[model samples]
Target: MSERHPRILVIAEAAHPEWVSVPLVGWSLAQALRDVADVHLVTQIRNRDAILRAGLVEGRDFTAIDSEALARPMWKLAETLRMGQGKGWTIVQAVSALSYPYFERLVWQRFGPEIARGDYDIVHRITPLSPTAASFLAGKCARAGVPFVLGPLNGGVPWPQGFDDIRRAEREYLAPLRAAYKLLPGRGATLHNAAAILAGSRHTGSELPASARHKVFWLPENGIDPARFNRVAAPGDGPLRACFVGRLVPYKGPDMLLEAAAPLLRDGRMVLDIVGDGPMMPGLRAQADGPGSGVTFHGWQPHEAVQDILSRAHLFAFPSIREFGGGAVLEAMALGVVPLIVDYAGPGELVDDSVGIKVPLGTREAITTRFAAELARLAKDPGALAPMAQAARDRVTQHYHWTRKAEKIARVYDWVLKGRPEPKPDL
Candidate 1:
């Protein structure tokens, strides 16, 4: 008798061919496990052209659920106005009217039926806890007698201790909103329903309940395809070209980068290339376009373009303090761009003394000073950059490869099904 390969179902809002890291991780896992397991992916919606280009066998192995049928009228209204015109009265009104019904009808209604029909050994519900999606999927998976896995890989971000401090400091202002959102039906139920949880980093793993902690797995959110991130000798160029690729958001710290680059601009030691778009773009542009603005914001580019940009750059600047998985950091590192990360949760786990610089976390001045110093040092000695860049590439090639990540995930499925003990790696 032959051993049966476990059948796994990955449920997420996004899926392959999309440029986002979460979807790309799902795509990579599905492709890696196709030869071994019967893998099926169910996502809300995606670009057909991108999925096709990813070379996934659609319908045969990968499938997407159309929630358009279950979508409420108010949901369309919210999306149409760009989520309440991006803020203020419109945002509050739109969220109040659309948030609940949107989750209950569009997400849960479609996700529940899919879970009931699919005989999956393990159901990985990505990022459903934020809303009511996880709770709904948990109930459906329970009915189907399958284990449910929760985490950023499936879509739950692990908040760090520093975040807790921030929450505590802002609790007076934020508690009411948090309480109101928690009051929504199905919030606590989701956390209670999950069978296992996975975090993208150690900091994230710390957020899980004591009971869920044992089940939690720490894996990077995305893996690199080595062929794509290969290292080439540095050009030993003029001013070091530093790249920052991601959504320009307050939490991402693009503003911090701009502030840091201000002094560097005066000295002409570093040039900043900002690639991405978000609510903070206008303000970031204002800061970068000023008299001493050395930063160049390139709105947004396609995923491939970002990769090409990383390959040509000398370093990657990622100052995000709220991120759970710094996919862009890993992507840049794989392409031989030395990553300068804040010594916070996500990036701290990916970078160390050997691979890249981990700056101490602080407000604008502290962060900017640390980053500027590192940039200056690297710019003066280009030879020092190659070793760290090579180490970064090697780290991804050896430990964070998609095949290895998928295999570990597959083992977790086996453990959930057969009641096997967890595999312990060498200490």
Candidate 2:
């Protein structure tokens, strides 16, 4: 509400410019916020070099906290217990919850006095995007009479029914006990003391206590950098070019997507480009090895290269069953590649009839059948997809770009600073 830009201390422990998923989300969002506010990012020391390389001056634009004293060991322990990489994400988050407090304590020790003296207009924790990771800083900020904003917190989408096998395959054994995070120390204070909450999904919103619902704003955590994903899709005149970019793991449903596109692949009416590596790679390769399969395995691309390959495709068919925040799907849309995703979780919420298509959630066989049918129809008349493809691009440009996300967040900052006025319509 002030004439000057608001001062924001953005905390993102996992933020790294070169990483993907939550780390990338944290980095992108924190960087984007600089356009809207005077942002000083506080992140884990591990990301210090990358942040510096990205041109932010240490001790001025950002502060790197060395919490690896506890964080590193806990992470290794989590890796051992998780069985392998790309599995047991819940286990990783569970362990992260244990070590994250140390990072916050160091943050408080370094900045408490400045906060108490009102050096920053807002203290926003952008990462530990998981709702399970509670913040003690919230209560501390409250005591100091400074507003602390939490989230766009996202995660904890229940494993859909009939996907128990896929759940087990992903090593998500701790999923059932995910609710126990509600009892974690500081969980209540984190909810009660926060000035505003940005729930990344309806599921994450429901997880918050009813008393805190008044401050909840629905905002998905995933966003795309238009500069990187600026290329437009160049759909060809041959077979319909479709891509699937994510881990080849079961929950992401690479196998299901392969089976679904089998008929089109076998008939030379479609081509599949799979980008990413995971534990399920060998099996997925075998599934697509037959003659006339029209499948190319381009595993684990650099973040920049993904758009180059994706922009050449006509569709992004993602069958992920339990995605918390479908960043990959958003990337596809940003490239003007119309997405065909399972109507569940994050991607389902992102796509609607005007921009992209959604297939109903069901057993593997049912999903495959529906996807096959949709692909067949699209292949029959590829020209019909042009409208939807353009719409997808327009939507991402207007609302899902990193700059747009930052502007929306600025609105939240204004609402909180203006004494939580009635009918905060922008949110």
Q: In model 2, what is the error at residue 164, expressed in angstroms? A: 1.2
Deviation from native of the Cα of residue 52 in model 1, angstroms: 5.7
User: How far is 274's C-alpha from truth in model 2 (Å)?
Assistant: 1.0
Model 1 Cα shift for residue 48 (angstroms): 6.3
What TM-score, over all chains together, does every model reach? 0.78, 0.97
- Candidate 2, superposed: residue stretches over 4 Å from native: 290-292, 420-426
- Shift in Å, residue 84, candidate 1: 6.9
Residue-level lDDT tens digits of model 1 in 38-97: 777666554445766767667765565555554445455655544323222223332433
Candidate 2, residue 178: how far the Cα is off, in Å: 0.8
Best by lDDT: 2
Clashes of each: 6, 0
TM-score, cand. 2 vs. native: 0.97
Per-residue lDDT of candidate 2, residues 293-320 (tens digit): 7999999999889998898899999988
Lowest lDDT sum, 10 consecutive residues, model 1, at 167-176
For each candidate, the alpha-carbon lDDT, in order, equals 0.64, 0.90
